[model samples]
Target chain A: GQQVMQIPQYQHVQEGEDFTTYCNSSTTLSNIQWYKQRPGGHPVFLIQLVKSGEVKKQKRLTFQFGEAKKNSSLHITATQTTDVGTYFCAGPPHRFNKFYFGSGTKLNVKP
Target chain B: EAGVAQSPRYKIIEKRQSVAFWCNPISGHATLYWYQQILGQGPKLLIQFQNNGVVDDSQLPKDRFSAERLKGVDSTLKIQPAKLEDSAVYLCASRRVRRDGNYNEQFFGPGTRLTVL
Candidate 1:
């Protein structure tokens, strides 16, 4: 079975502070996708990284895939109150049929 | 274009009872998925359908849970004789299939929150 692990199960920071969450897997992935779910809301797709050592940015958030393709990270710069939500990383392993999701990292920013 | 749609945003049922949830994916989307999300956890895939045909259902509890996607446009998930531990939010998502036969960028619906008492 394939498994993905996320670090810092929960994080709380000041509105102006920064936050980062890491996603790691024991097996390499063909592609990785990021999602955010607000309290009482459904999960929303954030981004997807497929190539090794790939990096993508969306406004204040930056996502990076490890050179080895088995790890990834999401970093938020100068978080805002609206950034409160849980972030999850998911991907399917090579030659696998189903995708696996990380436990998720909940983020809370104080005003 | 409209996003995925799910009915009965919330539900409450007693143990051993039965419940069902419905979902309609966006038009032209060929892949649909059902996931279970417990409080404080990520969504876990229960089943996946590719155009009315099941692609994966290894995680589904076939004895107590059953799902169907008739005509490849709408889907329904049913739970029979539910238990307390079955309480969770069921989410439905859909993705567009590319010409290369790859699917990406899943869009999720609001989800149905079920409480088993």
Candidate 2:
């Protein structure tokens, strides 16, 4: 079984603060995908990073993959109220068939 | 284009009863998956289908949970003799299984929240 662990199980920030969540896995991943789920809502796909040491961005959100492909990080700059949710990173569950999700980092945006 | 569709946004059943969930994947996608999310946890894969065929069901509780994707279209997940711990959100997702593509994002449905008494 593969394990993907996320840190900072909970985070609270003001309307214009910043936040970051880190993900680590016991096994090397061929690819890693990030998702966000609002309170009481299903997960929505955010972005995917495949190459080792790769970095991608969506406006204020930046995603990075470790050089060994065993870890990842998602950083939010000047977070907004819309950024409130739990962020999860997923990889193929067993040798690339299904997917396994991280416990997630719950972000609360304050006004 | 319509997103993945799931029915009966919420359900409450007693233990030992049977319940079923339906999912309609995004148009033209070939891969579908079923996941269960307990309160305060991430989604866990119950099963995955590759166009009407089972790709993975290793994590599914075979004795109580079952899933099918007949004809590679709408899929259903059933939990017979439901247990009290079966209370959770059942999510369905679909993606285009790539043969030569690099990105095949899995689009998830609104999910069916089930509660067992």
Clashes of each: 0, 0
Q: Please give, for every candidate in the order listed, the TM-score of chain B alone compared with the true chain B.
A: 0.98, 0.96
| Candidate 2 lDDT over residue span A1-111, tens digit each | 788999999999999999999999988888899999999888998999988999999999999999989999999999999999999999863257658899999999998
Candidate 1: residue pairs that collide:
none
Give the worst 10-residue stretch by lDDT in candidate 2 chain B. Answer: B96-105
Q: Go through the candidates in order and give each one's DockQ.
A: 0.88, 0.81
Poorest 10 consecutive residues of model 1 chain A by lDDT? Answer: A92-101
Q: What TM-score, computed on C-alpha atoms, does each candidate reach?
A: 0.98, 0.97
lDDT of 1 by residue, A10-82 (tens): 9999999999999999999888999999999998999999899999999999999988889999999999999
Cα distance off (Å), candidate 1, residue B73: 0.8
lDDT of 2 at A6: 96
lDDT string, candidate 1, B23-115, tens digits:
999999999999999998889999999999999999999999999999999999999989999999999999988897444899999999999
